[model samples]
Target: MKKFKYLFGPVPSRRFGLSLGVDLTPFKTCSFDCVFCQLGRTTNHTTERKEYVPMDGVCNELNEWLSTNGQADYITLAGSGEPTLHSRFGDVLEFIRTHTRIPAVLLTNGTLLDQPGVQEAAARAHIVKVSLSVWDTASYVNINHPHPNLKFDQLVEGLIQFRANFKGRLWMEVFLIDGMNSGPNDVKKIAQLARQINPDCIHLNTAVRPVHHDFVKPLTGEELNSLAPLFDPPAEVIPEFKTTRRPDFQTNEDTLLEMLRRRPCTSEQIAGALGLHLNEVSKYVGKLLRTNRIRKIRKDDNVYYCTVNK
Candidate 1:
């Protein structure tokens, strides 16, 4: 298979099946350094929007991937960081729409939607999934740890305004932590806000991957079920998607290490990319870890292996 600079996967996704991810920002560049982020803490937390990745380069890669391996459920604008931070986000969505029939999806942190340009760009996607984890400034700071300039109220207002203008499917994700935003008062406040925004669906998510903070933990099935009815739009807990079939590509230590040298990836991501089984990927990862060629880091609730230097 041909290697792509900006394209990452046709990886199995629980929400959007077999998603082909398009990464628009540099690794870990985001507006919010959420405690439950799967890509680890945001290394460059900022609200500034720029052409972080060359738009032409991304389109070129997309063209190449479509020509060779066009099989994907959704061409997702999500990977290591928030996709909305890229200044040409709408243009990229346009490019995808012009070139292919596959529907585009934008996964955002919902902080930048206050900007007219950001909201306009985001409105182009077929599905816009915004994350609203907290209802107040204190909880926002505690959970998302956004850039200094962003306010919780501004984010909520943006969602409400965006929904008023957007014609596509709008899905809101609310990430819950055990002691942070799981109380009745917090859930009720979030429910009220959800009603105001009127998203098509409200997804209840908890930390299911390895988290940067040790205190963050996944809610049990019962706990998730109990919280589902708190919202007016009726929330559903995001379920884990599992697969037993092995992927098509062959993976070895050198190939896995070479890929890790580029960016850290979870065993599941590696498995999907290399077309190998998760257990098979783990064998090579274990060997790499023992040899000190790669190190393990916890983000969200998944363990990602990366080059030691990274």
Candidate 2:
């Protein structure tokens, strides 16, 4: 298997099974830095749209992977940061459409959809999944901590307008924190906003995995179920991925070290990202810990392994 710089994982995904992730932006380069982000805090929080990574390199790598490995369930535009922030995002989507039979999916924060260019670029995807976690400006600031220029109402307006024009499936994800936005009043306001946006489906999610902030907590099954009815759209709790699919690449000690060198990850995340079994990941992780190449850190009751320097 080839070592790709920009492409990683035909990882099992709850929403899109066997998702091949195409990372566009650098790590933590996003407009909104949410407390529940799996990749931790935002290091570079901005709303600027530019070619962060070379467009030609991304397309070439993606084309090479597809040519060799064939298709997954979906070729997802997602990674360590926001995909839409790449200025040539539409071109990449167009390349996927022209080259492959597989569906193209965009996982975005939905902050920049207000811009006509961003909306037009996003429309190229077969399915666009956007996050709408807060109902008002106060909650938005509290949870998301978006760029200074972004307004809560503008973000909502963008979703509404984008839905009206986009022909593909529009799935809206609402991330719930235990104490932040799970109250009756907050949920009701979110439900009302969901109605106005009129997405094809509403997905209720929580911080089930390790998050940056200790205060960010996952909602239980019962809580998620109770909140599902608040939305007018067909809504359900997003389930965890339970698949036997493994990565095509070799999952060896060196591979594990390389992954950990990039960022901290749990056994499950390592398994999913590298296509290794949980048990297999544990073996490699244990060896790394013994070698003192990596150290373990606990956050939100979940353990993560990273390089000693990290």
Candidate 3:
């Protein structure tokens, strides 16, 4: 698979299988600076959604892939940052529908859901997954670290409203960062809110990959299992969902190494970015590091190897 600056994964989604993903916003442009974000930190944190990248350029590239490749289970609008920040997302969604039969899925942090136009744009998507990490405003600020312009009350209300207006399935993904949003009191409050919203499914997930902060760690299987009953419809561990084919996309070892230059990634993220098998990715990365194409750094006792030179 050839790498495109505009698109990245059909990364293994615990929910959507071999899902084809589209990056609507430019890199690192997001509405939140989550403590558990895999992409590191946010460079831009405003809610404004202009055509950050030319819409026509992205559409053309997407059409090319859709027309040539086998159909994916879902066409997900997600990438290095929040997908909802793309102001022309409605146009992008419409463009995707015109070109492919795959269902559209929108992955969002749920900060912008308060905007009517944002909600309207999402209506075209077959599924919308919103993140509900913390229950109260203080916890939301401490953990998700949304744009200063966004309000926690408005975000929750917007998600609730989106559930009402959109006819598609709503899946709420709760990434429980230990000691931050995973305590009994926090889970209980979040469950109350989930009950009010009534989403179709509640995905209880823990950090499986390296994240921005050193403090983040995925909850033990036992911890997640015990906490599943808090959400309205009740939550389930992400792995409970059936696995599908790996996502189809293009990426070279060089591209994978380039992405790794800035941050550390697990084998899964590297494979998803490059469209390679995990074993294959390990082989290339090992080869590169040995040849001085990259270097390895360890954080929290975890080794992250990356390309240090072009």
Candidate 4:
């Protein structure tokens, strides 16, 4: 198979199925520095939108991949950063819609959803999923740590506006933390607010992978079940990660997973052991990390990877 710079996975997503991810922005370029982000801290925290990765490069890679008749459940616009930060993301979605039968999905933080341009571009996707975990500005700032320019009221207004106009499925996710936003008062307030926007489905999620801060904690299955009934339509918990690859889609990814299943290893250690280049190993490792198949841990100076159940 040809190596791709702009595309990764047929990642077995618990929500979106076999999702082929499109990366439009540089790493960690986002509007929020979320406390529970699995990819770690945001290096560039801003709402600035630009052609971070040129549209031509992304389209060229997509054209090549599509020409081979690659299959996926959804062509996802997401990666290490907020994809909407790329000014030309709608054009990419247009390309997918024009050329293929596969549906598109947009995963966004909902901070920029207030902007008309962002909302317009976001509508191109068949299903749009936005994050809303807090009830007020104080909780939003505490958990999401959004850009200074973003406001909670504007975000809610934008979401309500988008829901009125959007013809596609709009899914809202509320990420609950142990002591931060999972209490009866907080959850009840958030549930009340969620009813106003009125998404097609509400998904309750908790951190299952390694997070940016040690204090960030997850809610247990029982605890999550207890909180589900608070929403107007009642929320469903997000499931654990899984991937469905094609029959011809055998790669070093399988070997790496098997290797990590026995013991944890760093990226460098993985490359050396697998007889593969460090750069080549990163894509597969990232896919594994994103899907929650394997997790990273910091030990002294080195970070290591092991299966999530470990």
Best by TM-score: 4
Q: lDDT per residue, candidate 4, 54-133, as tens digits?
A: 89999999888999988888999988789999998889988988989899999988777788998899899899999889
Per residue, candidate 2 scores C-alpha lDDT tens digits across 71-128 of: 6899999886899999999999999999998999999999999999999999999999
How do all models score by TM-score? 0.82, 0.83, 0.81, 0.86
What is the per-residue lDDT of model 3 for residues 263-302, given as tens digits with 9 covering 90 to 100? 7776567767756544235445544554567765666755
Q: Of the pair 1 and 3, which is ahead by TM-score?
A: 1
> Model 2 Cα displacement at 57 (Å)?
0.1
Clash totals for all models, in order?
8, 1, 3, 2
lDDT of model 3, residue 67: 64
Q: How accurate is candidate 3 locally (lDDT)?
A: 0.76
lDDT, residue 64, candidate 4: 89
Predicted structure with the largest lDDT when compared to the true one: 2
The global C-alpha lDDT for each of the candidates, from Candidate 1 onward, is 0.82, 0.84, 0.76, 0.83
Q: Which regions of candidate 3 deviate over 4 angstroms?
A: 240-303, 306-310
